[model samples]
Target: MIRGVRGAITIQENSEKEIIQATDRLLHKMIDENQIMPEYVASVFISVTDDITDAFPAKVLRSLEGWSYVPVMCMKEISVSNALEKCIRVMMHVNTAKSQQEINHVYLEDAVVLRPDLASK
Candidate 1:
């Protein structure tokens, strides 16, 4: 079976250091919450708000141990008026036996407002 785990985090600024740190935090949380292994990940799709241009979130994956072969892509999130800013979102597809309802989605920082229902209590 295959499933998608979602996560998002908001950074304070469009700086490479902040973006990389926030992305690294969010990805680790998602992986820990879902007990996901790098080998099981099929691919990862990352999107960032238009205001974010300092770094590619996928770059963090490259630095992750054992994630060298994991496929990842990055793109700009659709621009919407009044939408969240400085946010980074990720959708990770992985081979897993867990049901969709069993999967955990992570939302941190200001990005928690983007998915209140899934954000941790």
Candidate 2:
């Protein structure tokens, strides 16, 4: 079955390299920790806080992971009051044997506060 997996991270800086590296780390960890196969991923949608415009997080993921065939898109996150800053979030849809409850969602750095329960899991 194809299901969505959520993951997020906060960039320490606004630099392109920092944003890209942070996204790469967060996504890789999410997939590895969940035992997700890269080939099974259908597509990915990434949203970044307004502070992050140096580069698109989805593009960086494809570049770093050699996921050239995976479809990816970028969007801006809703700037809610007191929201985490410099954050990049991902929703990856993939085919997996695990059910939704068994899927792992990663929340790294300052973004971990967004979903304390999932982070603890």
Candidate 3:
């Protein structure tokens, strides 16, 4: 079976260093929480708020030790009237046996406000 693991984090600024670091942190957390391996990942979809333009979050994932081959794409999040800023969101598709309820979605830093319920799960 295939499953989608979701995660989101907010960066302090729009610098490339901040984007890469936050994305790297969030990805690792998601992987650790779900016990995911790069080989089992089908693809990763990342979206960043419009304020984040310094870099693409995919760069961090692709540079991981065994994640060079994992498919990754990055996009800009839709602009809402009063939405969160400097946020990065990821949806990773993976081949796994876990059921939907067993999956642990991750939300970190300021992004936690975006999904308070999942943040504690």
Q: How would you encode candidate 1's per-residue C-alpha lDDT over 2-56 as one tens digit per residue? A: 8999999999989999999999999999999999999999999999999999998
TM-scores for all candidates: the values are 0.97, 0.93, 0.96
- lDDT comparing candidate 1 with the true structure: 0.94
Q: Candidate 3's residue-wise lDDT over 16-58, tens digit each?
A: 9999999999999999999999999999999999999999899
Q: For candidate 3, give the lDDT of residue 19.
A: 91
Once model 3 is optimally superposed onto the true structure by TM-score, how far is the C-alpha of residue 96 displaced, in angstroms? 0.8
Q: For model 2, where is the 10-residue window of minimal lDDT?
A: 57-66
Q: Count the backbone clashes (under 3 Å) in each candidate.
A: 0, 0, 0
Worst 10 residues of 3 by lDDT: 55-64
What TM value does model 3 have?
0.96
- Ranked by TM-score, top first: 1, 3, 2
For model 1, give the 10-residue run with minimal summed lDDT. Answer: 112-121
Task: Score residue 105 of candidate 1 by CA lDDT.
Answer: 96
Query: Per-residue alpha-carbon lDDT of model 2 for 1-121, expressed as tens digits?
Result: 9999999999888998898789889988988888876789899999999989888787677775658888889999998998899999999999988988899999999998999999888
For candidate 2, report its TM-score: 0.93
TM-score-best of 2 and 3:
3
Model 2 bad stretches (over 4 Å): none
